[model samples]
Target: MCGIVGILNRYEAQSSSLHTSLRCLHHRGPDDRGAWQDEYLQLGHTRLSILDLSPLGHQPMASEDGRYCISFNGEIYNYLELKQELTTLGHSFNGHSDTEVLLASFAQWSTACLDHLRGMFAFAIWDKETQNLFLGRDRFGEKPLYYWYDKEAFYFASELKALLPLLPTVPELDPVSIDLYFHYQYVPEPRTPLKGIHKLPAAHYLQISREDWKFTPQCYWSLENIPPVTGDPATLIRQELEKSIELVLRSDVPIGVALSGGIDSSAIAALAAPKYRDTLQTFSVGYPGRPAYDERNQAEALAKSLKLPFHDIELTTEALVDFFPSLVAAVDEPIADIAAYGHYSGMQLAASQGVKVMLSGVGGDELFWGYSWVARAARISELKDHYLQAPTWKAQGIRTLRKLAQHPLYQKLGQSKKVPIPIQSWFRPGIDLSQMTLSPPDRAVFYELSPDFVEALTYRPHLFTQSLWEHIPLDNPYCLFPLSPPTTLDIPNQISQTLFQTWLVSNCLSLGDRVSMACSIETRLPLLDKELAELVIGLRKNQPDHCLPAKAWLKSALKGILPNEVLDRPKRGFQPPVQEWMHAVVRENLETLTTGHLVELNILSKSFVQALRDEFSNKGRHTFMLYKAVVLEIWYRQIVLSSQSAVRI
Candidate 1:
């Protein structure tokens, strides 16, 4: 894994400045750096030396003719296999590395070369023969690519900050996106907090031609189009998932797992143990005194169950305070998810233990219906009929819904779904009798969709609106209702699919790729492996619990191999006690920075900052926003307000 930055300039410019931008990403690759320039294009690379640790593996790796050079920022886990295939077809290589395979693959196949790749990647290859620059991200977007385009040039980077300097104009902050940052905790793609820059979405690629100085992005893959599954495919899915996990674990370096004691991580660790059983090492992080949030015991138990060496890091706010200056600087974004504090610490701890690569169970939740919001929405939809009756019911409904909004998960769903009512207001609209338009089965399917999914996941608003219109005419069947609430497993499966293809790609996975790469860590996700994603995606949606609750399939698969106690436990993702930690390091710094900036420069409203902080300190609500505001303010002062160059590493 590494950081890559480049420019396709309209005006002819030297590649020297491009080298400066790549140098700013030195933390991503202190191991090796290279720059290649043509009359109209410049590409730069910062190497992490994951595979072949040789000068041959150093990029900008190029064709022998030097007409085609490339800079890449992620691993092609199947590169070794692809290399064998390419060699069979008479392509010889100088180095035993993925970079050479990639350069050769592109040279042989062009953009179609992506079809042969099966790992996380974001790379740019410039073809001097055609004066075309092609950039592609992995099918799952486990690696990030951000780009900015204008009349003079098109610039791209693994992080936004690296691209900020190439622009002739100062980066503009989009206030609307700031509102989204406040709503979602992290800004969603393809918009960044900056106005002009955009994240290249997963499953997509962009091509820029120097002749016309134009760029266009197109999708090369889609999970949405996977054909439906047939009966008795359970064993097939299990086999496929295991194959994917094995494929992704094929690294030469010492590899470890980030065990959270959850079903997902436990499954990966358990499966991987025998492969590296005696040598396997695991890492977990915890906040002392926060038992409600700590999963260290569960993690340790799993490690013991697998008989692997286990290590735990108990972090204090003080240790984290020392870590954040560089951590924050590394990410170069206001990552409002406080859990990243623990992830950053966990990576540091892993690095210290001499582990260079770490596998995580990140995409599992999105693949399975592990998040509470899915079930919560299901519960709310089930109860809507009971409450959509009397005038008094409506009023009471409003009151209950308002209280539900106070919960962070509900509030987040509220934002994602864009519920019409205030979070505090609970009253859902009573049934509309315009027309009982749909058949019973279809009507039931419509009702199974949560307000959150209806509001958030349905991209074709017109189709969604039409689906809702059909539901308006349903007869009140409360009096003669069946014992169960239409328990088709397919519903949650569809929801899981939506979460993976839409929200997970946009939110968590995207965040992981950018943040970890910014810190120069090559984070591997076992659950997002192409074969695994395809397997899970191909599962019958009708059996929502087919994977069972919290990776039931994983537990069952590892049943005899892993201790039953370890396999049967609940799922607990990396949750950090950031509310308390922020109070220690960020609170005072926030006050000092915001107040001093407001007083000295007289730019922002001091009263607004004070109110934001007061709310954060008193209620711990919107503290996420307060954190974001503080980070943004500090960044503005350092980059936009100060006269000093913002390109420092």
Candidate 2:
């Protein structure tokens, strides 16, 4: 809900340019600004007034004895409770702001304070007593923190834009990050477009001291390792989710929900409307003529049923064309999701209506098994293990029978004649006997038939210029599965872990934080509560959490809270008029790519640009690839090329 920056170096110079760098994140915090510094450390904050709207909430707040100074972003939803506990231990505060309470808790417990905290946060605490600086991010990465270090000093900020200005020099373009972006739509954690700039991984805290002048990050949480708790998962999910909603709703400003037709947002709206003291407003967006992508009707009906004020926006192709460049700028990172226009516009609508805080349901799919393809991928991994583990003649006979009788290639015979129930278990698991020779991760990528992902896999070979291709190591991004998914967990849970690390953090939550913060709207996701995630991970330990029907566990939690009309509705993405929007944006910007920074910098080949023009001109066969190219092109022009003479491959 705010922006925090730190300039901690071993320099004694004055005029740190701290204020100039903090102003770059003006949209993140428009309400108030503050700064505090000494010879070696400078801290700055821009406040959005989510809690304690009065001036009493001003930050870069320091302790009574002045041992520690804290500049923090995001809300500690459990701050009030922590304040009461701290009060009992003789700690007092002048204001009701969470920043004050967090500072007091750090004063009392020091680094151990992270154990008692429960919310999204990325903060820097400067300890004058020890001459050390500490950087901490939340368990689920709800808040973003980026930093870069040179031999002289360390710089950290809430956004990449803020940190980029203060760097010693423009860093080299990270070729590996670019290659991963084309495959996964966003670069994964610990890697950004620049080589030295890094994202502090979630559930991590780093400490750098003048004593050693070393910045070492220590991880505090992991989804891959957790003891399984034996219980009915449905009851636990409902209980924890309700508590999370209550916690996130503790804001002083007017609050609203990002309501959609789907069960995730609808469930939040249903549970939050009555609990909210005021009329809970809802916002949605859709394309005007595109009914397939529009959810206004269903969203409106839910808003009416809940007696909440409903506001909707209609995006024409022209508007999306105009929004493209701005989208690239607002989302400072190069994320290829065009659906960002919807989230950005929705928050703009909320901000226009005097709404400062909004709640979203982004982690529903990853928590419960919402993506059917991911579920099938889990089963396929299990099937691969079956093929490898059981190779006896009898087992091979059953496998061969399952392949012939249950595979889709042989499904025509089953339509007329009934297939046995046992054999049906093998149906539609995305199996490939001939192609199963590859490793588990590679095989999953090979069979993944999702729309953008299918083209995402093979585009790098044809798209990258020859020099750039050989210059960078284009390791096969087994993106369909995960980034080093753990083996101790079940296959389904491993898949969920993969999506959480790769897709959820890199794509869903990354865009969620950037786009929403761009509008200065504080969006809270109750579905992605940390406790709920740990519980679900435990449930998947002995049993397959996703092996049930798709999102069955989540639907069970929402059985009576939401109507069957929504509960039974199939899963949907934040879809837009993809083909129409693609044509509008790609055609308008084709010339830019042909003569643009990407080719001039020798990053992309001329042949690839011509192929892109050909695709958009005639039929637009590779639409996602074209969109990725445009995203990188505009992002390159604005973020990379515009930065002074960035080093290239």
Candidate 3:
């Protein structure tokens, strides 16, 4: 895991700045740094040295003939296997690391080599012979890659912060993306909040030449559109999941697991515990006195069950407060998720203990429908459909039942609005619904009736109606059985994939990559393997809930390997009690930061900032949104606005 940057200029000029920009990413690769430049291409890289701890592994790695030089970031888990194939085909390796194997694999298979890779990666390979530069991102975007281009030149980097310095002018935010961020807390691809710069979507590649640059992002994977199949899903799931876990264990370095005590992480620990035994190390974190925020007990139980060495960090609000500014700076893009601090603090503790690589069960929920929002979304959509599709008498009966048992009916209906009027007002706009309750999307339909609109339609309730049908589709299973879920794509599947591809890339992965790299730690997510992701998407949709249970698949596969009790336990996400912590520790700093710089910039409203601060100080329920807004505001002042008036970092 490292950072890579490069510049391809239309007109020749000094690129010493590329060195400085790459240096900013020194936290990403404290072990080594390397740079190379020829006629048109200048590439820089920082190395964390996970695979080969030798100079040979140092990148800006060139082919033997010097025709191609590649500056790479990320691990290629299948490099050894690919190396064997290349060796038989007459290629000699100079090192044992995956880096050498990656260049050799490219030499042997070119872009087709990407098809055989089974890990997260982002790299820029320059071909002196073809005068072409190839930039690629991992299949699932576990690693981040961004680029900025104009007619004059093109610049690419491992993080947006590196590229920001090279720009000669201020980049404007895309209004559409700003709105998207407000709705989703992260902007979706291929859109960033900033105009001109874009996150290369997952499973995509781009090739640039002196003449013209072409981007071809092929979908190597997808989870939404799986073909129909028949089988005993439970057994199939068990076998396939085990195979996937077994494959990820092939690292050259000592492998460690991030045991959050959540079902997902616990399952990974359980599966690998038997083989690893004495060598296995498990880690978790909790606030010292805040048991509600701690998973140490659960983690200890799992460790005892597996007989693996367990390590836990008891964090204080004081420690978190000190870490906040540094953590914020590490995240080049502002994000609302405070859980990043927990992950950062956890990684710091783990790395300090001398663990090199750690595995996390990140994709477990996306694959297994673990989150409540996903299930709830399906239920509500189905209820709206049921309410709309019912006979007049049946609909009247439901309405009557609704009055007698509103709570149960609403729970069964799978939709909730504190006040139904807002639902009608937000969607129906100018229409009257005094005698009618329309499904959500129908409200949008009434206002904008385009002749061609099928492709744009989705089953989201917020866009259509506030009532049962506010966002539900008639064909949507969620609409039919609001309480009961559809076997088809429910909230769990769709939300997970959407968040994985978009929000995770734009926010979580981006933030994780930046913060972890900023501290010189190469964070790896074993559960996020692309083949595993595609496999989950390809599974039978009608599989019994046992096979596709909300995070239950992991436990079933681990079976006797992990303790049954730990496997059955609930998910404890990497959530630090930021609200409580901030009120206790950083309330003063929050005020100073927000009022002093953030408000002065006018990027965020002063009134909004103050309200958020007060609400957070008073222990209000909506403090999370306030935290998000203030953090973003501070980010705008520090990274965005500060760059405008001063010399670039």
Candidate 4:
């Protein structure tokens, strides 16, 4: 809901540089701006005025006893409850702002206060007495915090842009991070595209003492650590979801729902309608000519059924092309997902309607078994031990047959690919005997990076680079807290944890925050509430796989509350007309790619780039990859090369 930046220097705190960095974050918080500084530390805050809309709510707020000063971003939904508890402990506050409450709670509980928080947050508390700085990110990384540290100084900010200016020199590109980005479509947390800067992983905090200048990061929470809850999953899910929605609805500004026709959004709208009633509004977007990509009609129908105000935006091919550069800029990272455009445009429409905050159904798919890959993981888990124990020759023979079946000559001979006997199928699992089909992670390995590209760049790949294509053990789910998969969880739950922790946080939530904030709007995800996610994880433990269908538990929980039509509809993701858009964008920007910044950086080969365009034009099967390449090219020109050269595109 706001932007925060700070600098801890061994020499002196520079207020001028702090002001310049804050200017870059102005879009994140346009309501108010304030800065506080001492000899060694400088803290700056840009406020959006979500809760307490008064002068007393201003931050770099100091505690009552003046022992702690804090600059916080994001809402602490349970702040009222914390305040009440603190009051009994002899704490007093002048304002109703969550910032004041947060500072006081830290004063009372110190680092342990993080355990009591239940909402999304990324904040820094400065201790005057101890001269120690503590920085914390929310349990699920709903908010972002990045920091850069060296012997002489430490710099932290809510966004990467703010920290970029404070660095003494231009940051070098991290090759391993670039490789990870290409594989995952986003750089996972604890690592950013820049070499020295790092994101504070979710559910973790960092503390630095001025005395020794030692920095220590510790994990305060983990989904895997919670014990299973005893209850009917359907009932518990309903109760927790409603409670989370109520807390997420806490805001002083107008709020809306980004309702897609999918069950996730539909269910959210259903639950929220009775609470906000006439004041609630709904927004959806669709491709005008692409009916397959259109969901506005379905969204409109659902909104009409609920009698809520509905707004829809039409995205054209031309519009997507024009907005491509700006969209990449808004993301601040190269993300290949085309659906991000839909989110960006939808948020723009909502902002135009004067909505300052919007709730989205983002984590539903990750929490529940909504993806085909997740179900596939369950299938894989069942057969993993058997597959590994099988004879090596038998596995090789099966793999050979699969490749042979796909040969052009074999297909031309009018021979059908042999379906493996049912007895042999268990060894192959989801694999079709006729064609070589790799699992998602295996496919990632296959596409890791072409040796040709690596040689062309002349960059040595490290273990972090190699790990992108390798399988990681999921034993310690927290190993990849804001990044990878789990080890102890069941296969299906492991898949859920992997996707929710890594994909949801790095790709989905990052895009949501950037695009929404680009329009100066705040976006909330009720499904990602810490309590709701924990409850669902516990519920999944006792419930049979069949009992929990893809979001069926939610549908049953809201049985009569939501329309049957909305609840029964199949899952349709927010996909745009990417194939058409990518082809068109590539053709239009072909010239730029040949001479763009990526080529100058020696990261991309001209021949390879041309081949991608050629492949897109002739085969068009690698639309996603081609789009990712284009985005990276543009991003390099804007972010990397723009600083070193005078080029403008």
Q: Pick the candidate with the highest lDDT.
A: 2
Candidate ordering by TM-score (highest first): 2, 4, 3, 1
- lDDT per residue for candidate 2 within 193-308, as digits (tens), equals 88899999888999999767877789877876688878887898888889989898998889888988998999899989887837579999988778998999999999998889
How well does model 3 score by local distance difference test? Answer: 0.66
lDDT string for model 3 (1-649, tens) is 8889988876664544676677667877878888898878889999888888878898889989898899999988777788898999999988888888988888888888888888889999998888788888886787878888887678888876677776777687554554344445556677775788887788888877776565555565566565544565456666666666676676555667878778778778777877777666888888877878788888888788788888878877777666676666678776766777777776777787776677777767655667644543443444445666789997787576545443444343333445474453343211212212344443211111211112123212222212323222344321211222234465335445554665457666776677667656666665676655555555535553422336665456567666667677666677688677645434635666456543453334555556556666676534444455555655666666765754552
TM-score of each: 0.79, 0.93, 0.82, 0.86
lDDT, candidate 4, 234-323, per-residue tens: 788899899989998888889999998887888888889987976789999988778988988999988998889999989888888898
How does model 4 score by TM-score? Answer: 0.86
How well does candidate 2 match the true structure in TM-score terms?
0.93
Candidate with top TM-score is 2
When summed lDDT is taken over every stretch of 10 residues in candidate 3, the lowest stretch is 444-453
Ranking by lDDT: 2, 4, 1, 3
Which 10-residue window of candidate 4 scores lowest in summed lDDT?
441-450
lDDT value for model 4: 0.75
